[model samples]
Target: MIDLHAHSTRSDGRLTPGALVARAAEAGVTTFALTDHDTIDGLDEARTAANTHDITFIDGVEVSVTWQRRTLHVVGLAFDRGNAALTEGLATLQQVRRDRAKRIAAKIEKLGVADAWSRAQALAAAGQITRPHFARLLIEDGVCRNNNQAFKKHLRPGRDAHVTVEWASLDDAVAWIQGAGGIAVLAHPFGYGFSAAWRRRALAAFAQAGGDALEICTGTTDRQQEITAARDAAQHGLAGSAGSDFHAPEQFWLGLGRLRALPGGLPAVWHDPRFPGADAAN
Candidate 1:
């Protein structure tokens, strides 16, 4: 199966790019995409690993975007990994993330957690510092039971430690991905929890802004929900895709390379015109 969505340690995922590729091969994935959060830094390692393992790999990135005041994650697949414009945009995002992480660390310190920044820095170890790194450190220090607890108690939206980040606009994000010769996909539509009207508006805006597909089935979403999302994509004349969104080995519920088939009657996003001959390439 083609698992078109995933992450690596270049973002909040537990594994490195090469490690993730090896794991996917072991898990029986014939094709995969390394859609790491907001960056393509992991692509080189993943590509090399895929070459070694003979797994068909797609260059991908999950860009964090803002639309109507909500965070929208758009996954760009089959991109030109060496595109200069895309790399420049990602560099800006990485800087924004660094700033947000620093603020989170500062807030945690005021809550009597000294050395939080140092702790996160150490844990990140030259990797991109993120809220998950802080969460992991919190778990290690017995401050929180797990990453979920840390997010719930300190890092989630509207909490003291929650910092509002300015993500790229949907149009700009889609343009960047398209410029990189990628198919832009709407990642996990249900995760936003939007109203029906809001969802319609979002989908219309995405199509207008040049999005290619919607991830109908992803980890944590049920079959019914997946069907509904698939229908939504079809109604919007978009293509459908699926993935496990795997992050760690222990997340059995989200096994590596496991994916539900896209709903029937929907054309594959690989054939969509929003992408530069993604269908032809595949």
Candidate 2:
């Protein structure tokens, strides 16, 4: 099976890129993508390992975009890895992410979470120190009971330490992916808590923005949610995509390629003209 959405230590994941690829191979994943958050440093190592393992490695990265005042994640698959525009855009994003991380650290410091910022950064080992890394540190240091507690009490948006800044628009994000010779797929549509009407509107907007596919199956979304997403994709004429969104072994529910099957009646978004195999759709 193909698991297109994954993470490694290049961003927030626990495993190194090579180890992540090796684990996916052991999990029976034949086609995989290391779509780490806001970074492609893991891709080179993952690609090398995929070659050794005889697996197909689809070039990917998850780009964050702002739409309608909310943060949305868009996954780019099979992009030209060396495209200058895409690389420049991601470099800018990395800087923005670092600035935001520092702000979060300062906010937590004011909240009397002593040394949490420094400790978290040290734990991150010079990689991107995400809110999750902070949350885990808080949990380990007895500041919070667990990762969820850390976020719920101190780190969620509009709370004390949340500081994710809007860096790119949805249109520009999709355009970058397409311009880099990739297919842009909306990641985990329901994560934003959009109403039915809002979802329809967003899908229309995304399609117009050059998005090629919508993730119909991902992580542990239920069958009903899958059907809902599949129907929405069909109505909007989006392609179908699936992935595990896997991060670590502790997240056993998020096994490689673990996803509900797409409802059979829908026209796959991968069949859209933007995909390489679009002609086979007919």
Candidate 3:
């Protein structure tokens, strides 16, 4: 099976890159991509592990994007990790994330977590303080029960710990991925909870901005979400991609390579030879 999206300790995930690849290999994932959030630091380790397991590793990143003031993710696959454009672009976004994380820490401080940033940093392997780190801190401090509750009660918009950071634009994100010889895919097209009309407009804008595909089958998607994303991909002339969005073993529903296949009549992302492991995937 082919899973075009997942994460590791290089980002918010629980496993190391090697462990991630080992697990994917065990799960029969022939084509795997470690699309960590705004970073490619784990690619070397992941690639080495994939080589050992005979699994094809695709250089990937889930780029954070702000479209019309709403945060969304764009998955870049089969990219050159050394390309200056993509490297520098992701670095810029990394700083943006750090700043937002600090702001979140400041907000959480008011809720009596004085060392919020420090605590969150301790949990992050690379010092990349993500919202999940904060969520973990909240859980440890008895602020929330779980990841979902942490986001809903503390971190999401209108919450006390919420902090909004303006991420890269759609055009720039797509350009960075393409410039690095990668395919830019809209990640989880329906997960943002936008209205149907809004999703249509956003999908059109993504296509116009040169996005190459959309995830028609994501880890968290239901039948309605999959069907809608597939229709959106077709209407915009984009390819269909499947991603588990796997972060950790605890998130069982998003186990490595656990995503459903694309619905009938949709063109898969690996249909293009440029996609990593397309030969084996097809």
Candidate 4:
């Protein structure tokens, strides 16, 4: 199977890079991409593990972008991970993430949580700090019953701790991915909760901004949505991509290599010349 999006401990994922890749190989994933969020630090280790396991590894990163006032993710696959421009841009984004985490901690502290920043940092353990770390801390501190409760009470948008920060624009994100010899794919279009008309508009803008593909099948098993996404991508002259968006092993439905195949007759992102032989399964 071909799975184009996943994460490791380099970001918010539970598994380490090597472990994630090893699991993918064991699960029969022939082509795998470790598209960790806002960072490529795990790619080198993941590539090494993939080599050992005889699996094809693609250098990938999931860049967060702000479009029409909503945060969206763009997955860049087969990129030059060491390209100077891409690295510089990602550095800027990492700084933004750090600053946002601090702001969120301060906001939640005002709501009676003490030393949230330090606690969350401790939980991160040298990895990049993310909202999930804070949520875990909240659950540990008895502030919330679970991760979902933490988000509903403090971290979700418009909540007390939600701090809005401008991320890279869609055009700039697509440019960086293209500049680094990668294809920019709209990651999990259905996850955005946009209305049907709004979804079309966003897809149009993404295509105009040089996005090359749409995620026709993500972690979800909603066949109707997958078909609709594939049809829309084809209508917009964009290629189709699929991923499990796997993060933790507990999310059984989204286990590595478990995604349904992309709808028949849709052009595949892996079919590009840059990824020769990757489309063999398709």
The estimated TM-scores of all candidates read 0.93, 0.92, 0.96, 0.96
lDDT of each: 0.83, 0.82, 0.88, 0.89
- TM-score-wise, the better of 1 and 4 is 4
Sort all candidates by TM-score, best to worst: 4, 3, 1, 2
Cα lDDT tens digits, model 2, 1-282, are 668798987788888899999999998887788998878888889999999998878888999888888888899988888988888888889999888888887877776566866887787784677888888866776778987789999888788778868878998888888899888999988877788788878888888886878988888788898988888888777778888888788996678877666789776544555544444422
lDDT of 3: 0.88
Q: After best superposition, candidate 4 residue 193: deviation in angstroms?
A: 1.4
In the order shown, the candidates' Cα RMSDs to the true structure are 2.1, 2.5, 1.3, 1.3
Please give the lDDT score at residue 238 for candidate 2: 76
- The sequence of per-residue lDDT tens digits that candidate 4 reaches over residues 201-263 is 889999999899999888884999999999899989999999999988988767888888889
lDDT tens digits, residue span 1-282, model 3: 888889999888899999999999999998999999999999999999999999888889999999999988999999888899989999999999889988989988777665987778878867378888888888888878898999999988888889878999999999999999999999887788889898888889999999999988878889878987888799889999998999889986677888788988998999877886576684
Ranking by lDDT: 4, 3, 1, 2
What lDDT would candidate 4 get against the real structure? 0.89
Question: Once superposed on the true structure, which residue ranges of model 2 sit more than 4 Å away at CA?
Answer: 267-282
Residue 2 of model 3: what lDDT?
86
